[model samples]
Target: MGGKQGPQHPRTPRRRFDIMSRYWTFLLVLVRVILPLKAEETSACPADCACLEPQHHILCSNASLTSVPSILAEGTLELRLDYNNLTSLDTGAFLGLSQLSALHLSYCGLRNIQPGTFEDLHSLEYLHLDNNLLESLEEGTFRNLSRLLYLHLENNKLTFLGPDVFQPMDKLSALYLSHNLLTELSNQTFNDLPQLRWLYLNNNLLSNISIKAFAGPRRLRKLSLEANNLTSVPRALRQASSLQSLRLSSNPIRQLGSFGRKLRSLTELYLDELGLQEVSSTSFAGMRRLRTLSLRGNQLEILSLPLLGAQTELLLSRNPWRCDCRLLWLYVHLQVMKSKVSQGEALCSTPTALAGQRLLNVELQKLTCPAFGSHLTTAAPYKVPTYSATTAKRTPPQVMETPKTTTRTTIVSLATKATQPPPVQHPVPASNAVPERWDPCLAELISKVAVRPKGEGALMVTWSTIGEHDQVEVRYSTGEAVQVLWVTGELAEVELNQLHMDTDYKVCIIPLSKHVAQCTNPNPTQCAMSHTSGWGGHIQPVHMQPTPSHSALGTGVAVAVLILVLVALVLAGAYKLRSRQAGFQRHFDEDGFESERYNPDPYKLDGVYESNEEDRKIFVTAASQWSTEDEDKLDCRLATSPTVLSTPRYVTL
Candidate 1:
């Protein structure tokens, strides 16, 4: 009750009036508590424009505002101060903007972001300060923005940036610092940004980088350093194992080995227009997981076999190459690897011998090595014949000194000589008639064939020449093919068995113009027709045809012993004859062998037995004197000999 029944019936009206007043007061308090009070929008500006949308938001973009308006408060959650002529952001300008979440200062003439410029914006999550004249960043400038997640500093004139620019932004995920003048980065700069994911450092003047410049933030997945002045890819970036794409196409690194080790994890590599030569096997060895490699527009002489790794598509166009046997080997190897060699214009770079030759045009199987001299050394594991005086007499088509003294006799088989077929003379094409041609058979034959002598006085020719050859030039592949024999005719019978055995070779008669007249038909189609005795003044059948020396083992031993005995006998005969002559001449005085005489005939008297007393005296005196002894006794000389025998003068006197 109403004040205990309204202070009695008489004062009831007064009590009721007082209670109503109290109720009205209570209602007034309730109204003050529940009523919606509006926050002040920026009313200091023009009436037609909306500067501050709410108590927490303000968009002053292109607002003709020179500096920050004073209406902003600590509760502001977003601000757009872009496109302004402001050259610098003053510290404490946003002092009370603690709730600011998005701050866009893009295209502002912000030459510098002073320390504590954004210190009050603790709730800031997105910051866009792009298109500014910022040359440097002060440390701890953004220390208060702990919740900042996205930071864009692109299109700035920043030459060097401090590591602590983003130090407070622990939850930052994307940081774009592109289009800057940064040359290098300091290690541990990115260590604090553990949750950083996307980092764009492209379009900067970065030339070199420290090893651990980007060491931290293992959770970072995407990093781009493209369009910088990086001559070579940094080894530190290879530690970014999660990296998927790397573009190093426009750098000056030439050798493939320089980057092979660092790019083992890269799946896509762009190396276009880089200089390269013969890439060694170790270059691409570690990049086993690599799938795409771009090697377009490089200086390569040959595509090496070892360069072709498994499951790789090689792009080797626009390069120089030496299309020879080695290239042929490479071509065959590539085909076996099943990796397509792209860029078809990759022809032989040799403009002279291999001009306009496409790699596809050459038949690898038909590729023949150029003619190498027989005297050349080879590393192949086969015993090739070596030239010597004794081995020279066995080879046919004798070519050596004294062409006229040596003879070549051609004896035709009396019966086959009449029935032999004429030599087939096919017209060879001008192109094919060149010194060299692309013929597979010739190549195979040269690689697999060997030549040697078969028997005494017989030259054996064995070869597998499947392809057409105008005339096979058969010479002692290794030794001199000439024979020194005593046969006064166009042909001579020499010995054979000089060639290496179990070897294939192509053998045909080469004309000997110096020793014989030119025959109408020198070599016939078949070997039998050409080898008929001495058809073309070659040699006798027994000598021209290779007859393997068929000596039994015992016979060979006996022959060797006979040769030794013959040599011994000749030496003994010469010795005995010399001894007998010496003995017989010794009896004759003047005619005998002269011994050095002490006294010559002219020095002695003819008839008288001359006394050599004076000579003997001089001889004894000279023999008794020694150089040192004489010098020591220089003062003593007193001995003389008398008449009969030069007796001791001192004793007989």
Candidate 2:
């Protein structure tokens, strides 16, 4: 039940009838689980497969059918051998689909599967080997998929998945290895998937991911790694505290490693098209439940980053922004969150008479800069990443040598990053790389508490405050009362209520401003009490859970099998976290069957990039090329290559 699909612009017809009413209500749940048998000679329907009777499915897509026609009528239930060329699947390849439940071997040039080729599909549950040419997968190739719940090995050529390669997929919950060529992921590689909640290793070539490869998903909400080469921010995802969407767009991630101030159940983050030039006002420190951030095509100029998480909503379109005075405080914060803090129109590209205006329509007194010799430099303060799994110590990645002429910026024929492509420069890893202080808390730096369990004994404490913090104290003790609630102004969620039911308590969150600080550590604390206390930062202990009754018969069948596995994981993580989509980087722009030498990353780059354009649909329309005859065909190809363009360069992870 991993839903939240998003990305299909709203030209509205009820948003295209709500995506065809969610694909006809998930095809009437595969036509009520297929079954109408009893029709003669192997249910006759194989020549160029299209069997539709009682819709037991089977649309042998682009039928170059390399054999699977195996007299299949055990009520065949959905099998669409996509764009076929079936390289190899062999071994009983559906020897009578035991009621196959959706299986689309996508764009199949399928390069070998052969391991009990889907052990007689015991009612398989949506398994699409996306645009295949799989590289390696054995652990019994999803050994009889335990009611597999969506597992698409996106555009494969899977590099190496080995370790328990998704072993007995314990009810796999959406695991798409996006545009694969997976370079690494071993230790408990997606460990015994306990309903892995949507983990699409986006456009892979992943540089060794495995701080215990998500030591076995415990409802990992969404982790995309958009175009990987991650440089830090993976202290094993601090054991995924039920992580809630983290995409890391076009990675080459350098800094902002403030490991998102310990994820606190992050709310959709995707540092867009990474090539970011500057943005650290504690680059989203402790993401106070960040709500959709994506600095679109980056190279951001003068963006003193601080659209803090408390209510963040930005995409910032194709960034190359600039309007100076350090971006006039985001053009006066976009005139106080105008248009709820933008989705596009962040244009500007520097003073060639304000190149293309609209960094929030310039003029904050013409956002000045240039006090002297200024090709606009001064962007230093950012050494984020704070890795700590108990006393951090992650060495290697101390390249800090910028200030070398403010780190290379040789744009010749104006931007578009000289025809992008070459972001494999990892940098940012010498763990605990500080540099971010000053917190008289005017919001955007402190006070974040995240509890959950809102039933028996109650608790839903979701906070985030810092200054003028008039109220908000919440304290759980298990050994007593609601402890304390208070909560006022800028109220960031609260629910406390009584206590001690299935007791697991130990919560805390202070934020009451009157400049009271006196809890100077001495260990033990559910966030100290006698009220006002002397505080001394850096304490982190996190681990922020539930259930019930004095029963008989051995904890009442383990609490009725843990309340029917927590009511099927709270109804599939609360209907996909209440229908997620704080613009989840539009899941790399909703694939839309992207294949054609899979991802020919194009943004009209030339100077050097080798493509990775998010899910390159090669500019289908920016109004068919943003005017001036595409800038005079890119200034006649930079005046027939007059050289020296340079830009994308980073390397050091």
Q: How many collisions per candidate? A: 19, 15
Q: Which stretches of candidate 2 lie over 4 Å from their true place?
A: 1-93, 96-104, 108-119, 122-144, 147-150, 153-169, 177-193, 201-217, 225-245, 248-262, 265-269, 273-283, 287-301, 305-318, 321-464, 467-653
Give the alpha carbon lDDT tens digit for every residue of 461-552 in model 1. 44333221112223232122321111111221222343333333223333211111122222333121111121323333454543456446
| lDDT score of residue 177 within candidate 1 | 91
Candidate 2 per-residue lDDT, tens place, 23-76, comes to 999988776665443345445778878788787886878978876677666787
Error of 1 at 41 (Å): 5.1
Error of 2 at 51 (Å): 28
Candidate 2 at residue 421, lDDT?
A: 31
Q: Once model 2 is optimally superposed onto the true structure by TM-score, how far is the C-alpha of residue 123 displaced, in angstroms?
A: 12
| TM-score result, candidate 1 | 0.46
User: Weakest 10 consecutive residues, lDDT, candidate 1?
Assistant: 371-380
Give the winner by TM-score.
1
